[model samples]
Target: MKIDARSVARILREPGALRVILLHGDDSGLIRERARLAATAIAPNLDDPFRVAVLDRDAADRLDEEIFALSLAGGRRVVWVRDGGDSLTAPLKASLARPSDTLVIVEAPGLASRARLRALAEAQADCAAIACYPEEGRALEASIRQMLAEEDIRIDPDALSWFAGLLGPNRAATRGEVEKLALYAGRGGQLSLDDVRMCIGDAAGVSLEDAAFAATAGDRAGADIAIERALAEGTSPIAVARSLLSHLHRLRRARIAMDGGQSRADAMRGLRPPVFFKRTDAFGQALSLWTAARLMEAAEQTQRLELECKQTGAPDLALCRRHIARLAATAMAGRRR
Candidate 1:
């Protein structure tokens, strides 16, 4: 059956009697996270190699062998398939024809409506297909709260709102940032907006906002330092790329509004997250520098870099940082012109 996003959390909490769970989404991080949660629900000891068996689509044909095989850890086995698509349809169908103690999870990219693999999972009994897309607005806020709660950390509402704006389109990235905040705040600590900013500090221990601000404001040196520090601290390249894209998009929107005769103050005021008070003048300058066409070009570059980061066997992190730095340099040149 097809599982709704709202129902996924409850089901994950108690996935009882389900045999096959297929998670397909554009949010690769969320897909992997849900798969991991489902696997752990079934096979508690994930560290036990015997209890967890991760396979590629090429191993689909051996599903029966893997699932039915007795676990060396002597409990339920988790048969996980990463990057699944149409190639595994036949093998999956054959394996699901019968049942066993193992819980099978197939993590796939966004599937088309007519995709047979998605259809098979939805149509079959004892199987479920979940669609995960980018979470935003309230959903993003809720997820942030939940993750923080788990770490026994509390966040101020303003800080939560600010942090939420900085995350999503990637659940793993969102989770990672939250984890860092928790670590910085120490156990059982309350997180203020300043704390949130400091924990997300840059190359010289400045915040992510500082880097994003510098890059967009055409400060190449500051952007380079921030990007380098963020990457060195284990921030994913895709995360940084996404943020840059968001920043550019915001600038584009504001610039477009101004072109349509809206006043600068009015344009910035209409932004959803609302530009921080201190940055209003700088944001206005970005509006002047980044034309609509220039914004589109920036977005395209950021997206391409994100794709590289997600590609298999790619040194995505370094590539992402380098691309962002180049973008920073380009912005600096644009300002000079």
Candidate 2:
């Protein structure tokens, strides 16, 4: 059967009579984490040779034998298939055809929806298929808070919002960064906005944010430098373009709020991912210079730029840089006026 997120914790903890569990998704970290939980539920000591079998793609030919073999220690066994795919589908189907106490855990990151292995797991009465994906918005924030709470670390609300915005979309990378932050804060420590900045401000996302803010604030030199650094740090041009577009969209919303008679400070404070304290001045400047109509035009152009970058053989880097430069120039002209 196919398991949803709501039942994932219970299924992993007490997978009663479940012969095979397939964990598949784009989020490799979540896939691995779930696979581990499912495996450990059957075989407490994953390193025990008699009770556990770890198979890579190359060693998948021995899967049937591993599944049928009885454990010498007299406990249930776990066969963990790493990098699983449709190639192992036949073997898995054959093994599931017979009765066995061994639990088979398949860790297949990037598995397609219609994959044969996934289909078998979902259709079989004694099997399950679980999809793992990255968390976003409130889900992402809740995960961050939960991870930090595990270490008894408290974070300010503003710090949590800013930190969530800065985190990458991947669950594993986000976990690693949060782990680093927890270590920095120590047990029972508190994290302020300044604490988060001191810990994670040098990340590539920060540079991208810098490029976006500088472009919108008419700081041509600063924007150029930040864009170059961000790309050099392995941030994609598409990501950079989206970052600027996101900033523009936020500015457009703030401008709308201003039109509704709200003060600039209120509008800025009302942003979902609250503006970082250090960028308040630049954000305010961008808000003052950009009217809703002009912001809308710039956003439309950015959408076009994103589409162009997605085309085959397009010079994405150059296009992104040129577009950012144009935005900076437009802001400069608005400032001059």
Candidate 3:
């Protein structure tokens, strides 16, 4: 079965008949977090060596034989496969032929639509495929509130709205910021906008987003500073590249909508997951700067650079830096005309 984002939390809590689930998407952080949550739901004592068995990507062959064996600890057992790749496909197919009561969580990066493992899980009645894309709009807001509520921390409405704009779409980073703010606020303290700015600052993915947008918006100096800050703070080059790709895709869609007779403002408003409230105006500005053709060119260039970064001998960080700089320079030079 395939489940929507809204159904994720509920399904994790009451997984009914789901015996195996494949959590895969571009958002690796969210995928891992959900895998952890699913593991908790299935085997609360994750620390127990026997109750939960983790099979890493390289050791995937073991799962082929491991799944048929009963757990020594018994009761409830969980078999987790992390960073699943093509290597595990045959093993998984064989194991799924006979459904075991044990819950199996397969964590993988975005799978193609015709991916064999993804298809297998989705087709099985006792399985589910959940995509863990970045949280946005209502889902992002709900996640903030839920995380805060757990810590008994209260945030002012405006503060929440401010955070809504700055929070990283990555679940792990977003949760970390929430936890940091919770501790900063102490118990039962109401968090204010200033409190958030002072506490979280550019650390919670603001620099990364700012760097991507500033580059596209033709602000080279700003993008340079933001990019530097983001890298210094440990954001990965691939993460920055992915963010740029996502923004470019959105720009292309907005441009397409405008060409089809919709006003730019209307097109922006129609965006699903909706642009962040704080980013609406800036995104509108991006639409003016990047035509659909230009955005497509940029997307292709970035995609190639991303591939280069992932290749064996490349200096990923340097290549990523060059890509962002070139794009920013290109955007700025075009705008001057």
- Tens digits of lDDT, candidate 2, 128-235: 899888676688888899899999999998788777765554677788889989999999999998898899878877898899999999999999999899888766
lDDT of all predictions: 0.79, 0.87, 0.80
Point out where model 3 deviates above 4 Å.
Answer: 202-223, 231-337
Cα RMSD to the true fold for all candidates = 6.0, 3.1, 7.5
Best prediction by lDDT = 2
Model 1 scores worst on lDDT over the 10 consecutive residues at 201-210
Among all windows of 10 consecutive residues in model 2, the one with the lowest summed lDDT is 162-171
Please rank every candidate by TM-score, starting with the best: 2, 1, 3
Q: Which stretches of candidate 1 lie over 4 Å from their true place?
A: 203-337
**Candidate that would win on TM-score:** 2
Q: What is the TM-score of candidate 3?
A: 0.67
What digit string (tens of lDDT, one per residue) describes model 1 on residues 135-185? 877889998888888878899987887787666367877777888888898
